[model samples]
Target: MSRSLKFALLITLRGFSWYIRHVTKSFLGRGQVPVIDSDAHVVETERTWEFIDGNDIRFKPVLASARSEPNNYRWLVDDKLRRRAMLSDIDHLRPVDRNTQTPEDAREMSDIQSRLNHMDQLGIDVQVLHNTLFIEQVADRIEVDVAVCKAWNRWLADIWSKGNGRFRWSCVLPLTSINDALDQMRFAKDNGAVAVCMRPIESTRTLPDIYFYPIYEEAERLNMAIAVHIANGNSAVCDVLRSPYDPGASFGMFRAMTAVSCHSYMVSELPQKFPLLRWGFIEASAQWGPWVAHEARRRYEASGKVFPDNPFAEFRVYVTCQNDDDLDYIVGYVGEDNLLIGTDYGHFDPSSEIDAISILKSRTDLSTSLINKIVDFNPRNFYAI
Candidate 1:
């Protein structure tokens, strides 16, 4: 055979081998236990933008190329860089096709049947979806942000409502205005939002502040869980609400915010204040719980300020983990009952895009029961689903 024919044959064999391997793994990953992904994000389609209704295309944040950079896209509003939206969901475990950018890229993130099929391939039983680009874009734009969030939530509900039971989602609250936030939240509950999502980074106000108390109260009353999914904190410039919308947080803020907020809630007796409230700090990983618990102990030793309850107690605290996190320490410090597993599906940069539970499911260091808790039972308990 000529060299060209040999090359063609080699490519065909490789393609066939990949298909066989993929099919086999997809079949094998269907687990007996349901895996609930506590924090999965979706790239919003133009369905979300439809609610904007002739707003200046420039001022309205939209996805655009990162100034000619290859394989990168950023959220830009009036030419100001907001955040890098995931341009692809290609799993790095395999060779990636970089030309996969399109609004249809969002179908894997937002479409009901597409996501369900992806979940089956990954061994995930259910995924709790959160908003992607817009959450950070609207962080500081106030009323403008409110409109964007309102549109996005409506679009989200319309799609997830059709998901049967496979897709559950939290709505993004209009955090800039109290009235707006409350109104949209009611709308969210009516539309079937299971929780409310906020970025863990310090917003115009830190989450534990009294300004957020009312939101927390309403969430508690509505039986809506609160989720603080991680964001870069670089994108937010919260202009509404109060005067000191702290702009101090950066990419490194999620871990610090998780520690600080939980500590504050415990120290200031927030768990008691909003006793029925539930919170999850997600995508920040689960490694910090022990350190924060130790600091709480240190402060207690130094100042004798005793918390009415352990902040790490199962009722008030939940944190999401990657397979690489020290699961043993997390369970020891925060309790296995409080853990949540987030595949971060479709978040291409750091997310495992495929088989989010395979690591824990296959871990020799963990017991089958502990694996089950992290992948299945714990998330259900956290979400009360």
Candidate 2:
């Protein structure tokens, strides 16, 4: 067939297939894709600031762009600069409704009630919410980072209590001090946090760094999972995401690099050291599963090296996958129980093209039970929900 004809036929076939699926779902009364979105995001509003201590020169994250790099943001402690920068001619639409105009009026992420409404419309039963901007700003300020994490956790605890169990947050920790991070993890767990969010790739230190062992020991003690949500723009290796065409490309590359390193640690001494600890890598596509598993086996066979008994075990660690990832290959190597489905709802970045749960449900290779396992069961197991 000619190229133009082939394109036309492909479009026609896809449309026809979609129509058939739509009608079939309608007939079955399953039009809504029911899912517990394992990695959705929440935009922090003024509510996050409600509990922050004002006496200590406290910090709150704002989207500010430097005149030097007008397209990218430079997160700083000065809320004045953060706000003035936004008001002072930034590009694109502010992440708020134009008719409202008021910055606070457009805040969806900060308000748990408003966020729940969005979830209702999207048929999302649950969401594992991560911090929007604050996770990236705390570079070296130890005291400031600790206080901010505590305040945010306090605010989140209040919301979670009133929310009647709709939101689950990954509590941020100040890694500058091991003792302080442990204290925050315990505090967050006491306040009902699902997991402790941290950077998986420590650019300064390798995976087997001794400093991390204390935190892992504490997490295992508390039975709290460590969620390595992909850090963006201004990590150790990359100053900014720097992708003019696709920012998510840079984020994906970061996630992939971080995830592979994390897996290497998991397959080696880290998991063995803290045998009770559980780790999860989020926002990174899980298609890397097969490659990592392949490389892992290749090394073990080539070198006759020591290895874990069940190398593909899903109990200790988990990775989240997008709807379009290679499912068969992932399941083949990573095991279906180890796979999780998460749509980055409300995130401005590129994510799954369709409702992730629906895509899993429609997979020809996955049985109904396996689809349920990916959508609901795995996440529950991963997060201890």
- Clash pairs (backbone) in predicted model 2: 43-109, 43-110, 45-110
Superposed on all Cα atoms, model 2 deviates from the true structure by an RMSD in Å of 11.6
Backbone clashes in each candidate structure, one number apiece? 1, 3
What tens digits encode model 2's per-residue C-alpha lDDT throughout 24-102?
3443365443356788655555556567777644566445667887766545554423212223233254343211122
**Highest TM-score model number:** 1
How do all models score by TM-score?
0.77, 0.76
Give the whole-model CA lDDT for all candidates, comma-separated: 0.64, 0.62
| Superposed Cα deviation of residue 306, candidate 2 (Å) | 5.0
Candidate 1 Cα outliers beyond 4 Å, as residue runs: 1-31, 53-59, 65-72, 88-111, 134-139, 232-251, 307-310, 351-353
lDDT of 1 at 282: 75
